[model samples]
Target chain A: MAESMTFLDHFEIWLRAYLILSLFSFLYKDNRFYKLSEHVFAGLSAGYYVGLIWQTVIVQQLINPMFDEGEWVLIIPGMLGVLMFARLVPKWSWVSRVSLAFVIGNTAGIYLMNALHGLIFKQLYATMGSISNSNGFAGVLLALVVVVGVISTLVYFYFSKEHKGVVGVTAKVGIWFIMIAFGAHFGFTVMGRISLLIGRAEFLFYEWGGSLGQIF
Target chain B: MRNTLPVIIAFLAGIAMVISFFFNPERTVLGTFQENLLQWVTIVGGFTLVLGVFSIVRVNARAVSRRSDGWFYKLATVISVFAMAIPSIMPTSANSAFGKVFYSIFPISWAGAFGTGPDSIYDWLFNYVDSPMMETMFATLAFYIASAAYRAFRARSAEETLLLITACLVMLWRVPIGEALLRSIDVRIPDYINMFVMNGFNLSVQRGIIIGAALGMASMSLRILLGIERTYMGKG
Candidate 1:
């Protein structure tokens, strides 16, 4: 494989290795190389999106359909998109509100239905079903824990009332559950980060380093 | 008219979306209307990215021109944006008029250098430069997380103790070696932690949070639809 590798391939490997090492340089301390890599990354990522949206949204979706398929109505959205550039002109900045309002309103509409049907109702139904649907003693206990946990957690967040009675005790229980949940989340995140770290380490050792040995 | 017109447009657009959800697109015009609205939203959304890129360019270019601190780095950023973006937006096929002109000016071998293709400059940069940097950046977080854990995992109070214990068990249960060690002590220890802590407690708290967030979202959406939430429209 190394014998067959071309100059472009070798260059690519060297570039990737350089970038990875430069980024890892930040772990020890910030340096010129790390800052350079960081800025390049930011620029490249933004540029990638610009090209992507231009191709995918403007050309493919809007221009093609308008010209080829005679979907002239698409001009409305195209015009609306152009209106967004009005922000560049301070005098006409308010003109961009029409575009902003449409996007926000559309998002709000989607969220309203999705939240009501997709999340709140489904979660409530699943909580109720978990208790009645328990098959064994362990299952029942788990279900009970869930029920108690949900109620207490909700009670903890209910700050409209004072926490001086049974609500106080339930709120305390809620805090315990929340702490445990947060701990679990933290553990999960650490596990994920470790996995990513191992992946970079493996790539550095095997792919980059192994290539060097093969080439030599 | 500037304010009132935008508010009205928002109400109409929002109501249309809500109504379209209830109707089947296959049978009704509302479906077609909904699709068009979504397309419009997407196109408009794309322009927001263009706006963002412009902002980046403007800020960096200003810094470079002023020869401010880190001006060289800012110049690299500005140059990078154009280098990556210009090639990506160029016509890929030499058969096209623009592509013919572009290739005549540049190298013919640079045909189809649009970002999506396998051999494109965009793809090459993304694979070699962008991706490696992103992965390494993310991997760096592990070090910070470890340092944070060392500082934060102290068992100061009962709640803190519980948190620490839970975090330890969860971390232990997640790894293969830790799971094996737990099983050696008692197989049920891991099982109990998974069932009681993860599925039961975590699930419930997540559910509560979801419900709370959903309610808040619904309320906010209603406010927007009613034109009561005009903050999105910016101040006059």
Candidate 2:
């Protein structure tokens, strides 16, 4: 397996190792190497996104159907799409507003209904259902915690109600819940970072260091 | 005419969209209208992306021409953009020599993960270069977070102490080592505690925040529909 490896194969793995190390160098201090890598990444991302947008959207969705398939009715939307470029012309900038208005209105309208049904009502139903369906003592205990946690967390965000007496105590409980939740999120993030580190280590030892590892 | 017209259009479009969503899964007249409107938005969104690419080119070109502080990097950026984009613009047939070469160079397993065709130069650049750089950039955040945690996680008060303890337990519970350590002690700690705290309490709190944010979204949408929030319409 080692003898069959080509120069290009070795070069690729080593280069990847070098780049990974260069990126890790930022943890020590931001240097010229890190800056180069960062700029390269930014440029590549912009280019990649442009290519992606063109392939998935413009040529496939717009040009293919409109020009090739002869969808004449699509001319209205096609014209609207072209108007987005009006922003490039100083005198015709106002023409872009028509497109922007449509985009924003449609987005806001879709999200409004989605957030209501998908997030608010669905979550409310799930929370209520959990309490009734809870099986054992532990399950019952968890249901209670969930109920209290939700109520208190909501109370903490209540701005108009002056936090005093019952509200004050509930808000205090809410803060505790929030802190614990934040802690769990942080723990998960730490695990994610560790996993990335492990991946880099695996590459260095297994793929890049394969020949070296075999030698040792 | 410029300002008032857009606002009116926004209001009409917004109301039509909401009315359509109320129609649910089945095909109604309004639902059909909404679907068409959505398709139009998708097409328009593509143009905005091209606009984005132009903006990047314009900015970098100016920086290069004017000999800005990091003009060398900006030049590099511009060069890299064209380098990645040009090769990607060429369509490669699956059965071609280039396709076979790519298949041998990049295994199907890796290519599949990256969601690219065999001969896609875009896929090659993304897999070998872009993903590593982006991952390392974000990985740097982990180090910074660790340092910050060390400084801020001091158990100076009761609340702070509780936070510190919870953070430690939560972190420990995620790994096999933590469970092993507990097992070694001959003390059986129920896994339910971890699940109850994280999944139940933590999730409930998140739901609360989500519901609150949804309410805020609805309110803002209403304001925008009513023309009360004209900031999106741009400067006066």
Candidate 3:
């Protein structure tokens, strides 16, 4: 709690309280207050980012090099960057595809090998190592549970063949694993939201209210 | 020419990138080309943000000009955009014009009051306006999601019953209240159950999903490279 309150502190607290209540208004029903806050938030965020990007990126990275240091080689990509604006002009829009294709192709190419190594190989290796490290009957049981869950879950998502009989049974088992995972995710998400709610409530009840109390 | 040229460009770029990653030796021209392309892509990405801002302005401006439903909201949006931008363009000190304007209007200060610098207005709006709104919006989602889960989480079959039981156990194991409730019944629980059953099971299943998704991504990337996925080039 801030004891020696300035007018700015009170002003900020009031602004925050109004925004919080305005957003919560949507829980009851969508209204103009919420709409106003939502739009203002969106605009402020986009505008703030524009400012940040200009300072950190455009000035430091692009402009400083071209004008101050005279690295004219940067102009090729700079030209490519300008071509992105061609989308606004329908006739010249195809020029933008060169830029987009370069991005997509490069990103896809980079991630292909990266994902294969990171996700597939590493995960498989870890699972196998875990199974190997397990000891005793209980450890074996746990290992079995993991193996079955993974295999069945993979089978459940296999879209090529129609699920029936043995395949159907395996997929059915897979659904249980998937549902449980979903429920766990749901629980975690709820807790995360509740934690944020508590933080806001605490600020409203203690800090904001306490600051106001000091003035009176 | 428009369609084919871009596709060819994509194929060449993708192939060069992939080949450079595996086959290009250190200090080779191919490696240098790969590095330069990566930098160029990042610069181009920044330009895309400009395109994004332009689109937002165009759309909101139209909504305001047309006097469409909730046109005032759009007006507010347009106004805030410029309002936020103005402060950042000027020096952010209490002595600076932008800072002076905010400080005189608000005139409130305490420990670490932020309206003293070039970023003063932007910081004020972000902390006071955006932070509260964004947090509360996400917090509100908790109630709706819980409601949705309650309605949809029905045990309709044997598999579903297994799901329900596992879910309940995992959820219970995760929270203090759930642990306290279990402890009250004189049934002592070990961390092993949480470790082996909940975490182990969840990790294995998630790994399966990760592997599947990785395979899908690789295949999709291949498609994009080969021009099978032409949706990015539009005509979709």
* Top lDDT prediction, candidate number: 1
lDDT per residue, candidate 1, A136-196, as tens digits? 9999999998998888998898899998789999999999999999889888999999999
- DockQ category of candidate 1: high
Worst 10 residues of 1 chain A by lDDT: A1-10
| TM-score leaderboard ranking | 1, 2, 3
Tell me model 2's lDDT, rounded to 2 decimals.
0.77
The collision pairs in model 2 are none
- Could you give the TM-score of chain B for each candidate, in order? 0.94, 0.81, 0.76
Best by DockQ: 1
Summarize candidate 1's per-residue lDDT along B67-168 as a digit string, tens digits: 999999998888888878987888876765676897788887667576566878888778888888899999999999999988867988999888888888
- In model 1, what is the error at residue A9, expressed in angstroms? 2.2
Model 1 fnat? 0.78
Q: Write the per-residue lDDT of candidate 2 for residues A152-184, one digit (tens) a residue.
A: 999999989999999999999998888878777
Full-model lDDT for every candidate: 0.88, 0.77, 0.77
lDDT, residue B12, model 2: 84
lDDT of 1 at A195: 94
lDDT of 1: 0.88
For residue A213, model 3's alpha carbon misses the true position, in angstroms, by 1.9
DockQ of each: 0.80, 0.59, 0.56
